[model samples]
Target: MYEWSETDLMIREAVRGFIDKEIRPNLDALESGEMPPYPIIRTLFAEFGIDTMAADGVEKMLATQRARESGTDSGGAGSGSGSGGGLEGQDSLMAVVISELSGACMGLVSALGVSIGLGATTIMSRGTLAQKERWLPGIVTMEKVAAWAITEPDSGSDAFGGMRTYVRRDGDDYILNGRKTFITNGPHADVLIVYAKLDEGAAAGADGADAVPARRDRKVLTFVLEKGMDGLTQSAPFKKMGLHSSPTGELFFDDVRLGRDRLLGETEEHRGGDGRESAKSSFTAERIGVATMALGIIEECHRLCVDYSRERTLWGQEIGRFQLIQLKLAKMEVARMNVRNMVFNSIERARAGKPLSLAEASAMKLYSSEAATDVAMDAVQLFGGNGYMAEYRVEQLARDAKSLMIYAGSNEIQVTHIAKGLLGR
Candidate 1:
């Protein structure tokens, strides 16, 4: 029953205006991977005062963290250390922006979401004060792009267990060697959050390091890497099935030397959690975000299909009069309503300070992503020959909707999380 407030509606209109002015004209170049999405994203930020707002918010959060670290204000709730509460009041606004952009250019939304939601949020929730001061300001403001690298060539869904990327202690620093593939914004990211296992075998001579865990069983650690660091090579963006504007690529680290300062939280026993826990902590948000993106895809497909059904006439009658076409439209409407309700319910829960559990988020992700994909494919079918062609844009949406099932942990992985949640695992 939750609905967008008047303010939310006003902002949505303004966002739509911005998209029409800024993104629509550049759709070809953006979709062709001919133009990176960052410049337009920055333009959107500046045009809407998002950059200013983000900068102010980050500054305030950092100041609060500083005060708490120095024992000045021991009374407040947040020191910018908790994982769940960075952007408390802006959830609805962010939902509006994400959904709007997703409908027009899902690639753009993916790039932005990985950078801010995964990259900056992870750092903010887990990094030390010095670490935050060093890396966060530019990222939150969209001045610098960030890539969160956890996926690898070998570990499609096994994540930590199959992780081959690893680090070893070297004096007070760590030497990292690994390759990360299918990384969003990896080609041009200014900052990178890399997760690697600690190779205790390399430190067998040290106390308590004699018993090295199996490679797959090693402790996972997170580190921050800057672009152009020693022995670091970022690959060119890959030719992808869809979402070309996001700049997906690979990262190769050949004995990349990382100072202790780069280690998140600067301790293996970070108060926030270890790398596995940190990454898992992001699953709920990431999954819910997939639902948001899915909703947009569903809504866009529903809108296009409805419009097309009314406009295209055959046998001296409108296609809308055909029973088969009507079925498609009805199904699209059902999907839109169901997905929108789920999104609204999530928003209401968030506003009430009751976020969904991982299992619930996973369920939302699974259903919404599948729904979006189904609706998009149906839109293509409803469009007939026009749907297969790129000119109509429905094909592009179909391709984009398919990705929602693959990333943020695949739909297959979502099932396991959902099962775990139900069984109280």
Candidate 2:
């Protein structure tokens, strides 16, 4: 229902064309365990500005201007200074780009999402000016791939409570010790945005008590750790049910010493003074990024399912001819529309400088991810046996769709968040 600009339309068409020519034909190879040729993927993203679209440009001209005005950049490793309109416009444009790219390949979309949404945005939101200066260029230029390290072996839905990682401050340096699991792009990441607890004392209490203790508040902080940081190690890519093209792995940080500058936002000692306000601003933008990715996947699943239903036949008629099929397709269409609108509206709200309640962001992720999974499963059903086969794209979509609900935040957690919000908690 959202109106698209002339440039938006043009970009969409161009991205579609590129995917058709370069990515669609290679889906089989990619799904069968071979990574898509990086050159082609890289070229498409570069030409379309998929990776650095948030920044607008490399000279930092627009970003600097926005920073001067809004006190932050366009959702990158800094603040923006521009009017709300500029930020909203960028979000809309980026959403279009994400949907188009994801329509062809979710794995590629995930890569781009991690790099721009999680990687670059972390720095923009929490990185010091020096850290931003050191890291933003390579990210925007696609020279360095980035990954987010938040989930761990025991922490998925309960990320904050389940974190076992600890950081010990020692003079001008901090020693990081922990392990991260199921990290996207972990094996390929040149830079990692890791979250660890600063207060080891808070974790010394009883088991379940420490899990979600109040004192652990100071433990919730982020750090920008890099590859080859001493005691940091990455395991080989783990085979996955879907998104095989994306390299997923575990990360181990054992007493990795980092300079003071590596800490994100403020340290625990200074956190109570200013860190809360800063984290609020940063997380608002980061949630928007995650919501955008979810919207993209949902839109792609809906569009593809609809298209497939219209083409495939059963009992001498197109499957889409059946009333039940029509109903499924209609439901998907409605869900897609709702999610798209929610995403855009959230971005607009964010641009207007409103922080999203945990419920709002979780709602977007929950609804869109569920929609994507439902549509993907229906797409496979509509395709019959062909959908189950790897030869067709539907099977791949179904596989890729599985993770959306689990990542970002589980649907169950999203439900809990919504409940908490309703209870006014």
Top candidate on TM-score is 1
Off by over 4 Å in 2: 36-41, 49-89, 199-218, 265-314
lDDT of 2 at 287: 48
Query: What TM-score does prediction 2 earn?
Result: 0.84
Cα lDDT, all candidates = 0.89, 0.70
**Angstrom error at residue 74, model 1:** 4.3
Candidate 2, residues 1-425: lDDT per residue as tens digits? 34667987888788888888888888777666465435566787677765455345533534564475565444545333222211234666777777776666777767766765667766665555566767777775567788888788986766666677878777878888899999878887888988787755544554775456654465466788888888999888888898877778999998899887777644554433333343434344544555565566666667767778778887898878899888877887787777778776875675687757877777777777777778788878877888898777778778877787876667787798789888998
| Candidate 1 residue-wise lDDT at 5 | 89
